[model samples]
Target: MRQGLTWFNIASLLLGFLFLYLPIALLIIYSFNESRLVTVWAGFSTKWYAEMLQNQGLLNAGWVTLKVAFTSSCFATVLGTMAGLIMSRFGSFHGRTLFSGMIYAPLVMPEVITGLSLLLMFVAVALDRGFVTVTLAHITFSMCYVAVVVQSRLAGFDRSIEEAAMDLGCPPGRTFFQITLPIIAPAVVAGWLLSFTLSLDDLVIASFTTGPGATTLPMKIYSQVRLGVTPEINAVCTILVGLVATGVLTASLITRRQEMRREAEERQAIANS
Candidate 1:
């Protein structure tokens, strides 16, 4: 027999959700307000969104953010996968402790320190601070996140499948690509999305590394916030939230459908056997 939720449980859950999402809900609702002030809801209107469209600076910043997020996430995923594979499959090697420490240190390090260190490193290397520097910085930090995700997925992987592939005359490279990659593809994709979100949401690091004409969306938002809160910012934030929600929903649907199909195929194979 299934027990229904008690009043206490329901109340607690409702309170938790409200505490987490109330600010976001208010911001989204106010984005449609006709009044210039974000706190006072005059009436529902899309004027702020329209005005936001005409803002060239915001558009440029968004474009730069998208580019950097995509590039950095892609590079981070590849490098992180390699790092995870090395640590998981290779057992031990020279400098293993140092490599592992470097990979995980960013997780606990302060963003201010990370940003300042990267800035100093860039200056010492004489690398011009701009989109390239920002992208590199994002990849450097985001790769650690990806590595952690991939490593967790790899920890539970079955080695018997790989051995079977090799027994069937498959080379090491072929076994990895055909068997291991498919098994870990979900984790890799998850890592990429995490890296992308981190790159897009980062402010302090991007601010430190960004030069003129290379502002990201987070940096742009921060600059506007210093002036004051406006409905325009709320509208922009709402749009961004919607985009992220849509992307996540679409990815989840795709993954679910693929998993169902894979399950059906496996069931059919079992029946045939």
Candidate 2:
């Protein structure tokens, strides 16, 4: 029975990994495939990547996407860090629960509904559907992701440090800028990157809100894929995957270094005493 269970677990692990990886593997493989019919192997070639380089529309869309991502991430990080700080520091209040729900509501709410609602709100307010409007929509959802990341980081932080800074006659703003922000900087930065990635990847909401000449890379990819899938799209996907992997590796390394430094300092103090 134990042997049977072990086999079952091994099978499950393989199955789960395959399920998670097969599509991505296929996408990466397809990018190198020379055939226009993406499924059939027509010999490997780097022509599609070259094609991506030559396609001006795709390049323009990518630029737009980058702009939106950067702007949204910057605003989201600032707004979300503030929100997380407030939600944590203020603790319970008359409408704290409601505020918390509102902040997190986006994560659970249907994307289609959120998209439609934002579209309607824009229309109702007579806001023109353009790059600015799309950025606003992106920032709305991006900020929610930032809030989630910052909030989790805040959970692990001890409040005593800020109090100590204040007790030392530091101004409130000085305490935050000097102590709290540094402690929370990693989380804030991670949140910003997350927001940027989400903004770049978003299609459905962007589709609803984006106007003429405001095409994002995802929108361009989706439009092209609807007509026909190509290695160019696959190349773009591979690039995104590579970028995300790089970001994750960098963050992990930084966090590990910080942890090791803390441990070393603690050990040194212990040995000295």
Candidate 3:
């Protein structure tokens, strides 16, 4: 019965994965199709790939998206790491629970609501609704993910090492830079990458906040998709899938390295004892 149940579970999971990914797999395959129709197969060719590169509007949107994602990710990483450190280390502070709640509240909230709220806030503040404002909104949303990831890493962290360094004449700032930061560097890096991907993939928030001539890659794709996806879109989708797969593999390697290092530390401590 247990064996049967295990097989059933595996089949179920495989089916679910196929259901989710088959369309994406089809998109990647169709990207090389010579046919203009996405669903039809007309011999493999890289013509669409060249077309994607030559489209001026898409090129501009891609550049804008890159700028927004990079800037938002950097800012989110800084602010999120700080928030994670504070939440993990200073939980006893007054209204700590409230602050943490507020920080995470945005993550679960509906995207439409979050975008609307940001739009209203920008309007009320009289901030020019442009690239900078869109970038800021992305940072605000992306930071929550970074904080969540880094906070999970920090939760498993042993604070005694940092405390010991402080007691041994290392200043708090120095200890953080030298000891605490190094230990969780993998998570921090992962968080930053996550923030970047999330920002790049965003559409609703960027749509609500972006002004004239500030279309992001996702926005460009979305607008065109309504008119039916082109061969160029298939090519773009293939590239994005490749990027996501690469990011996942890189993150997995980093996680594996961190685990190995942790096991080595455990063995070393046992030997010392």
Candidate 4:
């Protein structure tokens, strides 16, 4: 019975993976098709990739997307890290519950509502709906995700080390930069990566906040998809998929290495003591 159950689990796992990744796999495969029609595979070719590179519109949109994602992720990481530190380390403060709720409200809020609110605020302030607007909108939503990730990491953090540093001559700011930051660096990095991914994948908020000459890759792809799905579109999507996959893999490897090094350092410290 146990053996039968194990086989069933394996089968279920395989099926789940297939269900999740099969469409992506098919898209990647078709990206190499020579035919312009995405569904009809004529012969293997890299022509679409070449065309994607030469297509100025797609290239410009991609550049814009990268800029927005990078900028928003950096800002989100900083703000989110600060918010996480406050919520986890400060214990109780006046209006802490209200503050926490505001920080996390975006997580459960509908994208449409968030986007609409941002749009109205921008309009009210007479802020142009361009790259700046989109970046701000992304930062607003993505920061919440970053905060959640950082807060989870900080929840079980050992405060003794920080207390010890404070007990010593280390000032709070210095200790955070020299000691606390290094220890929680992995979580911060993970949060930044998550924010980057969210910004890159976001379409709704971007659509509401963006204006002329500020088209993102998603908006471009969506517009093209409405007209038709071409081999060029497939190639572009494959490239995005590849970039995101590479980023995730690199982050995982870096996080793992940091963890191993930390473990080794702790072991050495214990041995010395």
Candidate 5:
């Protein structure tokens, strides 16, 4: 019975992974096809990737996407961290429930509704639908995700260290910067990465908010896809997969290293004491 259950679990895990990654794997494989037709694989070639580089529209869109993702993610991280700190550290402040609800409302909100509402708000304010609008819209939604991540991390955090710092005459701001921030740095970074990914992957909100000269990679790819999927599109998608995979891997390695270093420091401190 035990042996049968082990085999069943292994098969289920393999199937789960196959279901999740098979399309991506196929897309990557087709990216190198010499044929312009994405589905009909011809001889393998790197021409699509080279051609992609030369496509000025794609290049410009990619640059815009990167800029938006980076900018929105940074702002989201800062604002989200502050919100998370307040929600987790402060107990029952005035309108805490309302504040928390507002922070998380975006998470459950429909993307179409959010996009429509933002578009109306921008129009109401006479804001142009362009790069700034898209970035602001992204920050508005992405910050909620960041807040959730940071708040989860802070939920079980040890407050004794912070209390001790305050007892020793450290100002609240100083204690946060010198002690609490370091301990929660991983969570903060994770939140930033999450926000970055969300902003990068977003399409509907970006489309509604963006205007001339600010087309993101997703919008570009989507437009191209509507015309037809080609090997070049496959190549672009493969590149995105590679970039995102590299980022996640790098972050994981850095987080693991930090964890190991923190563990070592804790052991050393205990030994010294």
Candidate 6:
């Protein structure tokens, strides 16, 4: 039996959405404000955006952030995918519990601790805190998220397909690349996206690990916010929000299309069988 939403449920949901989005709505609206004061709207203009474009520091920070995000997410995806495969497909192994726990620890660990620990580790290793350090730190933490996502997908995956492929003389590496990877590609892509977003949004760890001249967007925004909020900051934030939203929506649509195509092919196969 289907349970229809009641008035209370609808009201609660509306309140929740309003709580979440009202601030974002206000920020988007204020991004266009001509006044320097964020709350005091003098007029609407796109000068803030123009100003953002002209600000070389902000632009450089954005570029650095993109570089870190892309590099870290790619590395994280590769490492996390391997971890997920081992945890899901390799069965029990030595120190499995400890390994799994370590992988998940980052998810619940406080950022301050994680950042401080990474900073200390970098210092001890004599690694100059810079783009490489920041990227490494991001990969370390972000990989955990990817591992969890890929593991969840693997948990529900049908192993019979792989088994049948193996029975038909498909080598392990060949079967994984040809069959397993394709089926789980969506999840891997999602994991990469999740890692990318995390890397882009991270501030604390970056602050700890980054050296001079490697300022990321979040660090730049935080520095400016310490002084005061401005229409320019709002403009930057709005742009980031738009970018993240577009990326997420595009990924979702692609995943959905792939899933639908796979389902249709499966249905056709069933009919033929």
Q: What are the RMSDs of all candidates, in order?
A: 3.3, 3.0, 1.8, 2.4, 2.7, 2.6
Q: For residues 133-211, what per-residue lDDT tens digits would candidate 2 score against the true structure?
A: 8999999988987887778767767678889989989999999999999987878887887787788778999999999
**Over 4 Å off, model 5:** 1-12, 249-273
Per-residue lDDT value at 116 in model 2: 97
* Candidate 2: residue 137 Cα off by (Å): 1.0
- Candidate 6 residues lying further than 4 Å off, grouped into runs, are 1-4, 250-273
* Candidate 1 lDDT, 140-221, residue by residue in tens: 9999988987887688676888999999999999999999999888878878887887887899999899998889998999
Q: For model 4, how does the per-residue alpha-carbon lDDT over 87-182 read when each residue is reduced to its tens digit?
A: 998889999999999999999999999999999999999999999999999999889877876787677566789899999989989999998888
Alpha-carbon lDDT of model 3: 0.89
Candidate 2 structure, TM-score to reference: 0.89
Q: Report the lDDT of model 1 for residue 60.
A: 94
Q: Write the per-residue lDDT of candidate 3 for residues 1-273, one digit (tens) a residue.
A: 665578779899999999999999889899999999888899999999999999999999989988999999999999999999899888799999898998899899988999999999999999988899999999999999889878878887878898899899999999999999999999888888888888878899999999987899889998999999899999987887776676667766776777687778878888998
- Against the hidden reference, what TM-scores do the models get? 0.86, 0.89, 0.93, 0.90, 0.89, 0.90
| Pairwise TM-score winner, candidates 3 and 6 | 3
Best by TM-score: 3
Q: 16-99, model 6: which lDDT tens digit per residue?
A: 999999999999999999888899989989999999999999999999999999999999999999999989987888999999
lDDT of each: 0.88, 0.86, 0.89, 0.90, 0.89, 0.90
Q: What does candidate 2 score in Cα RMSD to the true structure?
A: 3.0
Q: Candidate 4 clashing pairs?
A: none
Candidate 3: segments with Cα more than 4 A from true spot: 1-5
